[model samples]
Target: MSENIIQIEHLNKSFGDVKAVSDLSIRVKEGELYAFLGVNGAGKSTTISIICGQLSKDSGKVIVSGRNIDDGMQDVTRALGVVFQNSALDMALNVRENLETRAALYGIKGEAFRKRLEELAEILDFKDILSRTVGKLSGGQRRRIDIARALLHKPRILILDEPTTGLDPQTRRLLWDVTEKLRRSEKMTVFLTTHYMEEAADADYVVILDSGKISAEGTPLELKNKYTGDFITLYGVTKQELDKIGLPMETVRDGVRIAVPNTAAATELIVRYPELFKDYEITKGKMDDVFLAVTGKKLVGGNEK
Candidate 1:
């Protein structure tokens, strides 16, 4: 078993009568890519804030990098870094200046700072934009610079809260590529929270919250295997047309979707209902399926309250 870098036990938080995080607990291992997922107002932000020492927890304990968050904040902070949703970059400063200022704040200077920047340049590929002012850079470039700044002190753990939220698909993939590579090279633990299901799919472990409580926790594959089933969607087919086959299915917007055990079952359906569907789609299962199954809600348009 890997050593846990972050441990939260029986964590509870509230605002007035509304509970933000209730009885939440998780053990995030070092060098692991952990996905912390939930819809809006699902307590994900509240929990992360408490762990980062930005907010006080109502009760329970949080330990990060072997330091209790409450009393050993200095130690915990030295081992942890966070890239929040809002851009933390100094818009007026050039990329190099931003890094230089942050390095100075962390007491890394001269040759050591130069060497550290060189190392990060290899992963973040920000060398080209070193002279470009942060506000003039694209969103993707800005985000990378933000992460590079967070890593100035070589923290053991990185907490990314919707780091790529507004980036295009290509930019998001680019950021993750750098992130994944750095995770391997630096042996750093990554704790990510995002609304993107596809991003969570690549995580080593996933924990989802709903209304201040953990709704599900497992590996992406494990969660999908347990919560979702193979299914086929017969596009351009009406439910009435499929009534002749007596297949149990739900009527979707386009047509009807029928659950199946495997390809064999899907083949059987196609064989029997050959003329029923003009077009069809077959999928084993997906993270979206697991989210819906475990939380009884959608990721994007679900009720937060």
Candidate 2:
């Protein structure tokens, strides 16, 4: 197998007059956990659908597991597995039944299928709930079932679109650990789209999409070093007092206080007027700061485009 498990070239797609994705090209190396960071409707889902052969691209070449998705749909799709934000499972079936049915659909049955199910059950901690109906399971459990279903076919590349969207912090963290284990143990190439910046932090590589284009692509540390310099957060009793700082500052509403970048000039401003900014605190640059610097807009707004 090639080092690059998935490769996209000059991908373009449109719906009527609106272009969802445009001239976007990227590559996901083997065993890489690539995070696609963008808000809702930033074309992240559209791109994933195109690559998975769920949706047709207006123009572009999508290569998955060395097969062109458009040219060899069957061959390309056979090597790819996709899990959407919403669970795609038969709620009436038990966890094991769901996986068994999926495997059967892919022409896998008998002893080999049973063995694969056993392995997945042990690895994903689904042993206890194997006989329990999926509809009766908790949200986290259902998500685990969804993941297990995706792995039943044992594809080389896996794509998850916001796999942990509504999961709790602990559950989300657990999913991250599971994904790491899959990559390390199975050498599965994982590609995920997430709005959570913290999730992006843990990825091997991050691609920030905005307006159907990639704004930044690098490791989390690399992005922080390239964009964020410092942080200037102001702790004040009131918003009026923050406004009265009488200097340019990026106002961020974190419940009560406001925050701004503590750049070199901001340091000079503090040095010149120490009394005015006595209540302010300076900290290292944050991922939020890096996002703001790159987008020129507050990260609070969920609109990535």
Estimate the overall C-alpha local distance difference test score of candidate 1. Answer: 0.86
lDDT of 1 by residue, 145-196 (tens): 8888888898899999878887877767777886787789888999998777
Residue 17 in model 2: shift from native, Å? Answer: 1.0
Kindly state the number of residue pairs that clash in model 1: 0
Using TM-score as the measure, the top candidate is 1
Per-candidate clashes come to 0, 1
- The deviation in Å at residue 96 for candidate 1 is 1.8
Candidate 2 local distance difference test against the native: 0.80
For each candidate in turn, the TM-score is 0.85, 0.81
RMSD list, candidates in order: 3.5, 4.5
How many angstroms is residue 88 displaced in model 2 relative to the true structure, after the best TM-score fit?
0.8
- Global lDDT of each candidate: 0.86, 0.80
